[model samples]
Target: MNETLPMTGKMNIAANDDWWRGAVIYQIYPRSFRDTNGDGIGDLRGIVKGLDYIADLGVDGIWISPFFTSPMKDFGYDVADYCGIDPSFGTFEDFDAIIAKAHDLGLKVIIDQVYSHTSDEHAWFHESRQDRTNPKADWYVWADPKPDGSPPSNWQSVFGGSAWQWDGPRRQYYLHNFLASQPDLNVHNREVQDALLDVARFWLDRGVDGFRLDALNFSMHDPQLRDNPPSGVPMERVTRPFDMQDKVYNQSHADIPAFLERIRATIDGYSGRFTVAEVGGPDPLAEMKAFTEDGKRLDSAYNFDFLYAPELTANRVRSSLSNWDGTPGEGWPSWAFSNHDAPRAITRWAQDGDVDRMARLSMLLLLSLRGNPIIYQGEELGLPQGHVAFEDLQDPEAIANWPHTLGRDGARTPMPWEANAPQAGFSNANRTWLKLDEAHKERAIDRQRSDPGSMVSYTRELLALRNSLPALVDGASRLLDTPEEIVAFVRTSDQGDVLCAFNLGEQAIDWAPPEEFASARMVADQDTVNGGNAIRDRIEARSGYWAK
Candidate 1:
């Protein structure tokens, strides 16, 4: 008998199964995850070395933050060379090594591709700004300002200040929805679209499994140069002025889907490839559906569902879930608890509020949802945001929006591996690029990996339970009519049935579930406290439970 026969169970991902469906993606923020050269910053080799740890978590793929060649103003988000890696993170060859190692572990590699903008120093941008006659002048969004030297319109950058910047050479204000140095690409141009597609193909050919497109909704804009209307209501977020506008014309353009389809078609041509968009806005459901409707665009996407804002109350979760409604082919929801752009969920939602229970509840909630879930680095250990002072802040967006916003620096701290090592086991340097909180060492991965009651252990249990149940993995969710204090749902599939419920508050509440959940059995829950068959005649606040 042949040992390598079909029954041996090889991955077959390269030829079979659409890999993105119901996948679990782990997001790696390279700068602070692990430092290999003792340079006080994490690099590609360190990530490769840590691949085993991530793969052990059983994620379907890994979404690596940008490591492209560039100045580090916004870390690697601002790209100088699209096809090559920055020397700071390591060479292009080092990235290839990471890709190869990740594949060996059955962990697909997906990288963050920032296509909406590029660093000012990029050869393409530099040449495009030389003069209007340059081959690439039309390559970016360049327009003449009004006669009064005001911006082309009322558009504002996400970071700060006007979105338009004056260029001496071009004698026009070029649009940059981010920093002046990071100019927005002229995505409306066919040549620009083709060039960007070429960049995507470069990584796909190099064996990448997928891409998590950054600011995908910002890819195209209104061609008429119309002014964006100021938001009728004052922005609830006082930290940044950009949120004050309706952004109807400035972004979320109708033509963006056409460009996305082009990219999707190219991805479809490649075997075993996938694409997910990172969309952030107010009307996320409509936008998400528009992008993924009828398979014409993005494979899946996650929005600001719970990334921002305060505590995850029962009503908020219920409302957010209602937006999806688990309808057929409308759009699939990919959820995230934390990422580089937002505050760490543990600290943002729980931690000080009831760290242990919140950690367990969040883990269970994310897995039970009907979408591909993404877990951020250090989240498994229940690591809280680092305490960063003004001098230690490196993120431009955070710094630009000071006291009004806490800034993302605190959430982007180095990952803790060793409980008592220097630099929280992230680096051996006298000083790290960002401060490592001394308190987090106690919750380091090395310390928690063996503790059954630790958040990491709970995470493993929750993920394992979800994986074991077919109904929870890919199923249609029916929202159960429960109290505002409790959000319960049933996941039904051909294989079996499962129940998911969460008590979104801090106090206990009694509730009767719908008749459908009577046949379900407990699969997993907050380890320290059980919901008792999820019948819970009552449940505590910030509590969660799952039954099969």
Candidate 2:
């Protein structure tokens, strides 16, 4: 299991050095992180400029959002060139420089790999649509129309309308689980999997430490094209329309892990490079388990367990974590409280002006849990959700569900780097893609970077503390007998024993640290709270804590 140090010689990863396990990963939404060019969009060069900020957070590595070449109809998810960087993001050379600099700074690099679909502009798809007999024709999921010229099935596009788009040249329709432009790849096709594997290998060869596979569960589809069953009284899946139904037919394909295994083998070939899948759908936890189970697939996977919850409560946290309670062989999990794709937890669970406490407690909870943690950009600074007007919105999902919900554009706003700088120091462009969210500026990273009481600083302290504690990183968790609204657990390792507690209620509750647990000391984070409510011992209203 000894890995050859690529820094010292021709490379290969060391399995035992599996750095991803319980590692703290920072997420960089490249487009909104920083803008090097005045072109009003963030690019790879912007990411390079922002690396110092990312490194200062004490992250083990970063998961840079997609920078792949694309038409950008769906941002970079509709990739036209898998192995190439988009002109909007920067050239491939820019990406290489970023990777080299990150490694030199002793940080691991994990970039996004969108294997589920491609832009219609992709040459392969263009050729496939030109005629039915083309070599790449079967590479995509093309279907004949049902009687009377309707779609082959009742599937709906994640963006808003029919999932099938007409291609005049071939006189057929192609399936897209998301936007019509971002067509799903036929992962069921062995050829398709091989091509995608090559894309991954290309990055591995380029020295990427790992990959964050986007929408992995959507890669394969049901050949039958059956209609999805309804969830009853159409509802939003967070902010996306695709959540209205059970999503049974469009995603969570049974054969996905079979393909994931191939992807696993590709990553395994490289040595230490890691991988984590972004799995979302009905039964995401089960799908996440299958994708990472028994070491046959990804290193770990993230779901909406914590992201979509209405409030950050001790019991809710307990219920979410308890669901994954399995033995050693079960698939490992990666936890995220906020990300570019979802609303910020502060906005999702805030009371009065206590959002700051919620931010810290959420991180403490995330850090104490038994999983790899992905701290979204600005979450460290305790950034609250921003407001984006309908005129400034870009997310299709947000636009479709406007007024009812604030839409995802509000959460996906630009990162605030400096409170005093114009536009919160994100860019100087006369007109950025989205307007600057007023509230986020005051909570910019630079303003709180040095403040010990700041959430950003708390994040650093907790991560540093966790790094020194073996139990926190590789421990087994067991629930302490506590009330349903209070989440308490113990994480044990060879280093020692550590116990955690959380108060997830609207009212306060007194809690006592267990005095009989061998030699237990209040290591750190003994009192966790949110919005005046104790999340740990006293169980502050809407708060939590971590103690040992």
Candidate 3:
């Protein structure tokens, strides 16, 4: 296990029953990744074209955002057809090609499964809405309006407004935790659960290595439709009525674990299938633990611990990682500093004029964590959030709450492939779904691919180091006592011990290296270390070091 894995060439991935444990997964937002067919939208073929790029990043797998048949209301989250491919993203042949290419490149492909909700255009929803007594009427969460014709309960949608939508034909209100066009599924129904499981089988049969369950906790809701109680503590940045409520009844239902068991069973029938749920709510940690507990559900789960954090601090890292301290039978955790739904880490965590250094430090921190690390598209390039004018906005949530919410559109911009090419080589079309950030050109893939000091190259080095070290991958991690401005942790395993330290602050700090780490050897570039005293004392601002 002391082999030094290079990031530039073909290599065999660990073919163990638990390859997902501590694996590095690269997340690809299809619409923003790379466009083919000159449609200004990334398609399955585009993913195939970039398979080499992803493989070169040294990640174990790739988690592609939804490309299923959808009306594009919530992008692909509001799936119109569970088993069909979206025409906008090319046909099924293109998908199969991408899967084959990824597998050939030794990269496992994990597609998003949005079973929590479906587009209003879905056939089942259409049939259910046609009449209350239809065969598919119970497929969605439907409730009768109150005597005064108001919503059945006080539940609110995550995107603002009421969670219940009025249907004229059925004369009833349907529950929708997200956009009105996206109706919550009736997972409580045995038939609906079976149907969704069948959908999983379809993809597994098609050779997808795993699934990234989108909002798994949001799949099941309280059958009572009770009004959510208000939070006692006032929210500091309330954007919608949804934020005011505790969100107890609308999400994180107790019945979710049972459904997860069924999903796990289905995936278990297939060889080497992995599942990771995206749990976001009032108590994401508790929900994530429950969803992945007992090894009978998902293999891993990630919460919004670092996704929406305003500042990156020592306490935040310690507190978040502490929740997943590897208890017996406890579920494994997956971590991400940036994703399609959140702002980029460079934009959110970097101090003024320190984006490049912060980017490298963040990669080292992510790879050194005691869980699977998911690198979002363009995160390797250290791309910042793109700026979009109010008039150019396409996201429903951002448009509904302008000037208040930072809007995920900024983070969902196109990936800059070629620094000088039109549209940054994302697509040949002049117009893209979201505006491309001007600053991204400087951090484009072509520009950084050859620069050894570039963020992309640094990411490759850090990932390679992580892959080479068994201690950093599957070892026990303990937070070390350090100043508030610095985060230090010791990872231990049978292989060896590794110490990772980072300065989150802007000013250099004097740090007395632990006796155990006095003779440690550096793993990558010690950009922030004071060469004057070795590891005896000193740390530069917005930099980190990994030593064994």
Best by lDDT: 3
Q: Between candidates 1 and 3, name the one with more favorable lDDT.
A: 3
Which ranges in model 2 have alpha carbons more than 4 Å from their true place?
1-16, 233-241, 526-537
What stretches of model 1 exceed 4 Å from their correct place?
1-15, 528-535
Tens-place lDDT digits, model 2, residues 1-548: 11211121111112245767777889988888888787778788888888877766666788898888887777778889887888878888889889987886667899999888899899889888889898888988999999899999888777777889988999999999888888778888888888888988898999999999998888888999898887664443444545566788777888888888888888888877788989886468788888888998888888888777776766667776887676776888889988887888877887655787677767778888888889888788787888888888898777787877756777778888889887788888877777778888888888787676777766666666676666777678888877767788888888776777677677777876565553454555523222223223455655554445
User: Rank order by TM-score, top first?
Assistant: 3, 1, 2
Each model's lDDT: 0.81, 0.77, 0.85
Q: State TM-scores per candidate.
A: 0.95, 0.92, 0.96
Question: Candidate 1 vs candidate 2: which has greater lDDT?
Answer: 1
Model 2: per-residue Cα lDDT at residue 488:
80
Name the lDDT of candidate 3: 0.85
TM-score of 1: 0.95
Candidate 2 has its poorest 10 consecutive residues by lDDT at: 4-13
- In candidate 1, residue 398 scores what lDDT? 77
Q: What is the C-alpha RMSD of each candidate to the true structure, in Å?
A: 3.3, 4.7, 2.5
Better candidate number, 1 or 3, judged by TM-score: 3
Tens-digit lDDT track of model 3 for 324-438: 8889989999999999899788788875857776777777788889989999998888887788899989898889989887789999989999999999999999898887888
